[model samples]
Target chain A: MNEIKIFSPATVANVACGFDVLGFCLDSVGDHMVIRKVEKKGIHISHIEGFDLPYETELNVAGVSALAMYNTLDLDFGFEIEIYKKIKPGSGIGSSAASAVGSVFGMNELLGRPFNKTQLTAFAIQGEALASKCEHADNLAPALFGGFTLVKSISPLKILDLPSPDGLYATIIHPQIEIKTSESRAILPTEVPLNKAIEQWANLGSLVHALHTNDFELIGDALNDVIIEPYRSQLIPEFKLVKEAALQAGALGVGISGSGPSIFSLSQGLDTANTVKEAIASVYKNTEIVFEIHVSKINTQGVKILK
Target chain B: MNEIKIFSPATVANVACGFDVLGFCLDSVGDHMVIRKVEKKGIHISHIEGFDLPYETELNVAGVSALAMYNTLDLDFGFEIEIYKKIKPGSGIGSSAASAVGSVFGMNELLGRPFNKTQLTAFAIQGEALASKCEHADNLAPALFGGFTLVKSISPLKILDLPSPDGLYATIIHPQIEIKTSESRAILPTEVPLNKAIEQWANLGSLVHALHTNDFELIGDALNDVIIEPYRSQLIPEFKLVKEAALQAGALGVGISGSGPSIFSLSQGLDTANTVKEAIASVYKNTEIVFEIHVSKINTQGVKILK
Candidate 1:
């Protein structure tokens, strides 16, 4: 009960139609972490492997998120965290969210689950905000709660869990390039055409309906990003080409995963997802940018305990 | 089968957050029309009752919509429409939609159902444009397809039918004031803040989810219209006061039904809907404008055949 080992998952926010409010979790792609009650009075980073992230408690997402949760509970004993990173930071597939959620999820487990999922999300967002320079629960909600999630509102923090239809798979292509979330967000226009806004919301509403009905054609039709993609795609090289290739290769839909540098294509099955991945990989191979492709089923379980 | 007498229900479009794409049909508040196949080669308006309207095929919405269907059919026999009007035009409660839908629905039945709901929506929209000067399917979709409907796209004409939770009721207040739909639409800004757009889409996405899951509290929270209501409310007198009163009376949410002068409140049950109606009626009582209130259950059947 004093120690816990967990696997925190990566997530894809902005599922094309929902810009800052919707996200889905990814299976088989995540970071492993181990946390145990220590004699120290505060959160401590015992070991870090793979990724070269900050070790400072205030600087790192894991340390900061864990501290956010720890500060609330005036417990006597402290917890020590050891992270084995697999997902790279800034890949736009919720690498930071995995760290943010891992610490809180594991700590909560070690503490006999004091806080609920909503509270865990609240704590996780504090660290996620450090990465994006803005508060967004899209990735944090999915990474914490699993499957598809709609960050319905931020003020009262209402997160709606949505169903992920069977056979749905995601193909993520992470280009080895730096695209700061803040800079990418800054490029977006403060105002959007009212017509475009209507179009975007219509697509988002339909996408939610399609998910519930399990209509793949409707899902493909609703996977349009007319508002943010036009602007954010400019930061990722060959985004248009990659998206076109993915669509041509039978992906249900394609868009930048988050702030980008990573592109995600959603398909009906693993075969179509793999086809989309190979098509996207070929597009990147011709370019000077290095990229990694991962195909995974939509993760229904958010964070899992590592046995 | 050669003759049809039908009751076409009124609808509340703009169901708060959905703006141009969402609507729900209303029970018992509509118009009745009798359509029959005649030897004439074109549409004929045989009689008009309860309201003053043009009998000219092109000038009348019922005649115009029926003609639109007839033109495409190229049938040997034409149809005659007799309107027993109950809903007043410019009431902001889909009065025009009732007429537009009635004729097309009746004619389709007389022809043994040649056109589907989408085609009926298409033909009905042509007549509806005579009143609104725009082709919006929010009201038309619900009036034709019944229950809650989302007009997800305009060009391709994608209409998604959504479930109406049990006990859902609508309270509509129509103030005797003149507000043109075109003018009401003109007052809105061409652009909206991106943040506001994001908030709107989030609410809309949540609303869609709420409909699917039958979550009433979430429906209340998600029935927020930040993008369109602000500008359009100025056209209606005491809109804010009426909305506040309805909410205070336990109504789930309130918004301008379609454009202006008429406001609709959705409540959990018939009792709450009656309470909301009384509350809204009280607000308009102090003002100089005359008003009428109608409370009804959410109509799952759009257009019903009269026995």
Candidate 2:
């Protein structure tokens, strides 16, 4: 039985107006996995190295996803899997997605990579579905194909990798507060105002244009999220102050990243990036939430097997 | 006084879901105006060629516009204007916009180009207000800037000239039928469905992206008008067949051009352009409405004063 090892990058979901439709990978934030072929008739799962993951297949997001693929394809291969959880769970980053994607990628490699990227993405999304109890692809997309991506459609899951815009930097602030995906999803209203929806689309359209053209000014102009940001922002403490401070500190723009508790600011230069970090750190001064700041570049390559 | 010969190109307005906020110019189809300085106190306008236009200052669309500019700026420059109207009235090809923009540009040149493009655009929109009875910047924008444009806001009327996407061609079909702007405006519902609005925005956003990227496939996919098209398409004869034929003929897409009777097809290349034109022209084989077919490149330069 040969052993296979793979690494899948971290992802950010619910990118502004895209909600469940858009996401991207982060080369700096991700996880690793290992899969070993076995002669035992079924799959064996072990939760190792600080994952708090259960050994049961039904409860195991990664294991269940691997099993789903096997059942759907009626494959007879038995396997054992282990995951190295790096990104903390409940951090508003795609912590679960890293596990699910790592598992899919690792299993595919163990099985000789028969399935393509799209197929792998579908399997990874199934794993995400087990964890969140909702079929979501926003996180799985970037986890599969790195870089800024738009899920044009979900029926067949048509994903597109946008051009890597230059002169743009990202600063993410992760505050130590738990925000469940279910809770975040529940808070969104099923209906939005017509005028506001128009504005949201306009901004989103402008954002896509800005990324393609590498127009920082347009990107700044389009960062506004009128539909979800205004309503969900209340969940995060100091949301207003953080955004104001980041903008004041020379960020081209700032907004709530994915769900609440964690926020990100976009800067055009290094000086602005530092200012954004300082601004966010200052906002968390009075609270003991324990915050961490990441000054990273947009990851164009998502998940890669590292030894 | 010097005779200033200025030409205002014909324009395509209400670009897809942009409704009243987007437009672009056409090169071959437009109106020509000759403005000669006269020793007079008020502007005089005469329809010299083609269609009949009003001669009285208050009744004439061009004269009223020129008078408005003069009265607003408190300038006492007088001129004699002759309009060569190539774009017919009520053809939905921005016929009156040519007159209004012609007046504004002609007057600006007569006044030594004092007002910039933006200022002239404002005056041109004001003229359209009298014609449409509702303030819209779609037609006037393209008339001023000559290429693809986005009207970001209408409160103070913010206009943006979008990139003229490459490898894209336009096949405009003006069905010789009169559908009044007043009637078209009246049919639109004051309230829109929330979900429909979101879809509209999504399409609008994707359309903008397609334009910026010059992705003709995406442009074709994004040229839908679910909310407005379905309802307004009822007014055009052989609308369904025309659209189907255009799409079948390899047009990236097809849609009503600015509150039609007039329909326009967008193609990716010259072959597709000819195919789309033939497809559209074939539908009018037995219809009484005379159709004028125009194969056009996106006009990057709007109104030019050709001496």
Candidate 3:
């Protein structure tokens, strides 16, 4: 098997109350990458498809992640890569993570799977860091390992795969607008009030407990972000209206996906997910902003090898 | 039944990582309250034993809590209560909570158990507020419900009873020193760094996951307090030394139990709990500060009714 193709799913990070520590994968809308062994000792992007992205190895997340994995192994072999992007960049839906994770996952498979999921995540993070300017596994971990993932600690890179409750569905709306991840992040306050911080942690703890116990009402009650959302939501158009509509349509919770321009809602079943999707779209219907909505179940299978 | 007796166990609040939100009950140390029906229209404390406590129902935590319950129910009858205190107050353990919980639990039983555990916790908090001047249910919730408890929210009172993993043991060291709860609480910073707050919430989320999943190593790694413990540890005698010795003795984690003077360590089994107890005692062997050590399993039965 000298060639391999892998698909990495899009992910939602900072899930409401969990700021930088929690995320989960989406079943659809991701990036596909194909890797083939080369004679040279370095990675190269031989071809690109579906989206306009930098073909330079260092500039691209997929190429950078693949190069990092190859350099770490210090192998005499290399790979030629091709990326078919489906999840658009600047969508705030973990587009970079899909690219980075797909690259390393394909490389690992080509290299006879030398590294475990956690190790693959580290290499993927290195790739993602080149784009995001910081190391965070909230997106990469779920993209690599599938399902809901918790980045417990980033120092030594500890990741825990959390249990996704039954009947959980995701409804996402991507408006045709772009907000840079760096800019969205810069808008946040460096310091939060101590009381709000306490409330945030309490909700976070409750959220985790609710997930484990499968308490839907508790999940709805705990899906509050008292600190980040209040500030970041300003950057997104129609954020409040969309959220209110989603909630009115039976979404258990709704919040901005990643940073902005994209919003996601969680529902208990397929019918509610579709209802939420329509509700979110109805807010943008009369407006000039063009939007796309996707309804999916919680992605249990994260990144997968296609060939 | 006209007369009822109940024992409410002592609890350790905060649990290192979950400040103001998490706590667990202890088995042996508690307060026993006996309540008998009277023809009067109000609650009363007829007798007190083993502690220098006020007989006035309004001033005492036990009496205050019972009175709160009675007032909430608009009861036509009243009860005379007798208290036999075992857990000493101002021990940095939930001594006051034991009293508060014991009184309400006994009254609930004598009233034919009308209110549920969560309702009982609210009454217990009312009782505790008479002493602490604040409503915190970290200790009271665990004492009322037994085992590990998470006070998810204070208003509209949300208490979650967490699972206690098998083989989990607790070792507590109570140095004969008094650190007023108000004083200890006052020493903490009103504002915490956002970075430290993020780290704390991450550890808290991980700790709850560890409890539900029965991951001991994760529990040890996640049982870190970056906010309150640093400042409050100064109030305890040989706090650092005792914590170091506990860790050296194979204890999974060690920190201040509630506020100061009493430090507790969590271990995986009976042997490690005993070893941790001895290691903690060795730190104060030459000092004049008299201390008491108790080692026991996680108390599964919080407050129990004894007829």
Chain A fold similarity by TM-score, each prediction: 0.98, 0.92, 0.97
What is the lDDT of every predicted structure here? 0.92, 0.76, 0.88
Per-residue CA lDDT of candidate 3, range B175-285, in tens?
A: 998787778878988778777888888888888899999999999999899988999998887889999999999999998898767899999999999999888898999
- DockQ class, candidate 1: high
Residue pairs in clash, model 3: none
Tens digit of lDDT per residue, candidate 2, span B188-302? 7755665566556656666776777777777877787766787788889899999999999998878888888788877887778888888889889778878899888777888
Residue A1 in model 2: lDDT: 29
**What's the count of clashing pairs in each model shown?**
0, 2, 0
TM-score of 3: 0.97
lDDT of 1 by residue, B10-116 (tens): 99998888999999999969999999988878999999999999999999998888878888866888888999999988888899999999999998888888789
Candidate 3 Cα RMSD (Å) = 1.6
* TM-score, structure 1 vs. true: 0.99
- Residue B195 Cα positional deviation in candidate 3, in Å, after optimal superposition: 1.3
Flag the better candidate by TM-score, 1 or 3: 1
Model 2 TM-score, all chains together: 0.86
Off by over 4 Å in 3: B74-76
Residues A23-76 of candidate 1 have per-residue lDDT tens digits of 999997999999999988898988999989888888889998999999998888
lDDT winner, 2 or 3: 3
Give me the chain B TM-score of candidate 3.
Answer: 0.97
